[model samples]
Target: MTAKILRTRLDCVDYQEACDRIQNWAIQRNSCYVIAANVHVIMTAYWRKSYQQILNRAALVTPDGMPLVWGIRLLQNAQQTRVYGPDLMLAWCDRAAQSNLSIYLYGTTETTLVSLTRHLQQRFPSLRIAGSYAPPFRALTPVEEMADRDRIHASGASVVFVALGCPKQEEWMARQQGNLQAVMIGVGAAFGFHSGEVSQAPRWMMRFGLEWLYRLITEPQRLWKRYLINNPAFVVLFGLQLVRGLIKGQ
Candidate 1:
C-alpha cells in the first residue's frame, strides 16, 4: 500500500502498482470503483460534501493528473507519478490479455467504442473484450439502467471501464457497487483518447503538468470552465490545507 495525500485521498501509487491492484480486484471479483483523481475531481469533491463522500468511499483513487502527483509528493514526503486514466486503461488491457481477464467498455459514442475495441484488440491480440455499449446521452429510466446492468453481467466481464466523465461516472459506479460483481473503473475520456477520436497531450507536456493546457486548447468550448476555474481553485484550497496541516504539525 502507498501513502495517501489526505486532502484529496490521492493514492501515491505508480502505474504498475495501480495495474497490480486492478488485477487483484479482477481475481477476487470485487465490486468496487477506482477513481482517477485529478485537479477537477479534487475541486469538485472539495465543493460538495456528497461528492467528497463518493471519493472517500472509492476503493482506489489514483493520482491521475500531474498536479496530484506533485501534491502527494509535497504532502506525503514521498515521490509519486501520475497513473493517468487513459494510459492505465491501456496498461490493464495489456495485462488482461496475458491474465485472461475479460473486460467491458461502457459510455462514449458507438463509433468511438468501435474504434477503441479495434485498436485494443489489435494491440493486445489476446485481450478478451466481452462487450461494449454507448448509452443514450441522457438519464436512463430504471428499466433501461437495469437492462444495461444485466447486459454487463451477462457478458461475463471481470472489469468494466466507464467513460461517462467525472461525477456522473463516479456516481454511476458507486450505485453499481456490490450489485455489479466486477471492478468498476471511471476512466473519463479514455475511450476518445484510446480510439484516437481525441488527441492526447504530448509526453513532454504531460510530464510537465501542461496536459490540462493542451486539453483546454483542443476543446476550449467544453473544457474551458473546468481548467480555468477548477485549476486555480484547487491550488488555493490545497495550499490552505497544507498550511493548516503544517500549523497542526501532522
Candidate 2:
C-alpha cells in the first residue's frame, strides 16, 4: 500500500521489499520508473500538478527522506522506515550483480560517472555495467534524445539508474517510460554519494533522521533554502494533514 503525503502517493515498502520489487521488474524487462520521495519531492508535487501526476503514476515511490518515513508511520504504517536512494541504489547494484543483470547509468558528469562506475565495479566485482552517459545540462535536442534511447537500448541493460536530481530526473524517466525497455530509477544524488564526490551522513545520524542537517552543513550554499524553507513548511503542512486524518479516523 501507499501512504498519502500531501498530494503524493508514497509506496509504504521497506528496503528489502523495494529491492525485491525492482528485481522483479528487471527480470520482466519492464519499462517503469521509481522515485525516491523526499520532503522536496513531496513539496514540489504539492505545487506542480504535472510532477504530481508523475509521482502518482510511478511504479514505486519509496520514502527516501526521514521526514517521509515518519510521515508514513504517522499516517498509514506503524513500522515505516526510510528507503534511502543512495543506499537503495547500492542494494540494487549488489542484487543485479548476483542476478547477472546488466545496468546503465544516466546523468551526472563524466568525472562522477567514472568514479561511480569504478567504485561500483570494485564493490561488486561481478557487476556488468552495460553503459553510462552524462547528458548535457541543457535540454536535449530530438536527435540527442534519440541517440540516448538507442544507446541504452543497444546496451542491453535491464536497469538504468538516473541521477539527474529532483523533477528533472523524474521527468526524464517519465519521458522514457514507453521508449526505454528497462526499469528506470531516479536516484537523485546517488551518483555523487557513490562516486565519492559527496560524503553521506553517518549511520547514527541517518538512524536518528538527522541526515538533512548533515547535508545542510556540508553544502550550505546549495541546500540552505531547501532545508530551511521546505523542512519547516513540511512540518506545518503535514501536521495539519495528521490532524485532519485523525478527525476522520484514518
Candidate 3:
C-alpha cells in the first residue's frame, strides 16, 4: 500500500512503509533523520520553537500516535498506524540486525541499559550492539556533550538510538548528528518499555485511544500532570489549530 500524505506542514506516513522509505532515503541520499512524531512529540513540535526546528530539520517524521494518525485522516484522509518508540526500536533492531548495521543505545539508567541489552540479545539473537552508554542524571555541559559525541563516533555504530525522553532526546539528536556519523533516532520510553522496567498498555486500550488512561492508572504520581494537564490541553490546542487552518483556507 502507498503511504498517504497529510495536508499539514509535516509529512504523515505509516510505520512499515516509513521504515522502508526512510531506509531507502538513507541508502540513496546518504543521509536522513527519522523522527517518531507521537502526540506528545507533535504537541512539542506544535508549541516549542526549538523542538519544531529539530523536527523540521529531520529527513522524515512518522506519525507515532493513534490520535495523530486520526488527526491526519481529518485533513488528508491518510490511514497511518502509530509508529511508537518502543515498537520502532524493536522494528529497527530487527532490521539493523539483518542488515549488519551496528547500533548504540544512549540513554536511560544503568539498570535499564543492562536490562535492555539483555532483552535485545535474547529477542534478536544476531543484533550487534556496537555500544551502549548511560549518561548522568543532570544536564550535560558542552564538554560532556562533546565527550558523548566522541564516544559514539568511536563506537562505529551506524544507528544511534537516543532514549533520553522527549525534548532531551530530540535536543541530543539534533546536536549530535553532525558529530556522530550515523542515523540518530530519538526513541522516547522505548528502552524502558522493552526492558520490562515499564509496562505497556493493552492492545485494546491502545486501539481505542485510551493508552494514556491506562498509563495514568499505572503511574498516577509521575504522569498525572501529563495526562490530566497536557493531554486534554493538546487536544484543545490542536483542535483550535484545525479550526484556524479552516478559517485561513476559507
Candidate 4:
C-alpha cells in the first residue's frame, strides 16, 4: 500500500519486497519506472503538480529517506523501513546475477559509468550488464533521443538503472514508460556512490537521519539550499498534517 506524506505518495515497502517486485517486473520485461523518493524528490513533487502526477503514476515509489520512512509510520504503516536507492540497486544486481537477468546502465558520465560497471562486476561476479550509455549533459533532440532508445532496446536488457538525478530522471522514465521495454529505475546518485566517485554517509548517520546533514557538509555549495530549505519545511508541513489528523480523531 501507499501513504501520502505532504501530498506525495510513497510505497510502504521494505527492501526484500521492493527487490521482489522489481525482479518480477524485470523477468516479465515490463515497461515501467520505479522512483526512490527522498526529501528532495518529495518536496519537488509537493511543489509541482505535474511532477507529483509523474510520481503518483510510477510503478513504485520507495521511501529512500529516513524522514519518509517515519512519515509512513505515522501516516499509515508502523513497520515501514527505507528501501534506499543505492542499496536497492545493489540488491537487485545480486538477484539479477543469480537469475541471469541482464541490466543496462544509463546516465552519469562515461568515466563514472566505466567505474560503476567495473565495481558492479567485481561485487556481483555473475551479473550481466548488457550495455551502458552516458548521454550529453544537455537536452537531447528528438532524433538523438530516439537513437538512444534504439540502442537500449537493441541491448535486450531486462532492467535499466538510470542515475540522472531526481526530477530529470523521473521525467525521462515517465516519457519512456510504454516504449522502454524494461524496468527503468531512477536511482539518483547510485552510480557515483557505487563507483567510489562519491562518498556515502556513515551508517550511524543514516540510521539517525543525519545523512542529509552529512551531505550538506560535504557539498555545501550544491546541497545547502536543498537540505536547509526543504528539511524545515517538511517538518512544519507534516506536523500540520499530524495535528489535523489528531483534530479529526477528536
Top TM-score prediction, candidate number: 4
After aligning candidate 2 to the native by TM-score, how far in Å is the CA of 31 from where it should be?
0.8
TM per candidate: 0.96, 0.97, 0.89, 0.98
TM-score of 3: 0.89
Alpha-carbon error at 173 in model 1, in Å? Answer: 0.3
| RMSD after CA superposition, every candidate | 1.4, 1.2, 2.9, 0.8
Q: Which pairs of residues clash in candidate 2, taking residues 3 or more apart in a chain or in different chains?
A: none
Q: Model 3 over residues 1-250: C-alpha lDDT tens digits?
A: 2232222244655556666764664344333466777667766666687788888788667767777777777766555567776788788788878877778899999899999999999999999898999999789999998898789778877778888878888887787765666787778888989999989999898888898898889989987876777678778877887888799999
Per-residue accuracy of model 4 over 1-250 as CA lDDT, tens digit each: 9898887878888888988999999888899999999999989998999999999899999999999898889887988898999999999999899999999999999999999999999999999999999999988888888898999999999899999887899999999899889999889989999999999999999999999999999999999989999999999988999999989999
**Ranked by TM-score, top first:** 4, 2, 1, 3
Clash tally, candidates in order: 0, 0, 0, 0
Worst 10 residues of 2 by lDDT: 67-76
* Candidate 1: tens digits of C-alpha lDDT, residues 159-202: 99999998899988988888998999999998999898889899
How well does candidate 2 score on lDDT at residue 179? 88
RMSD of candidate 3 to the truth, in angstroms, is: 2.9
What lDDT tens digits, residue by residue, belong to model 2 across residues 1-250? 8788888888888878998999999899999999998999999898789999999889999999888888888787998888999889999998899999999999999999999999999999999999999999988898898899999999999999999888899999998998898999999999999999999999999988898899999999999998899889999999999898888985
Q: Give the TM-score of candidate 2.
A: 0.97
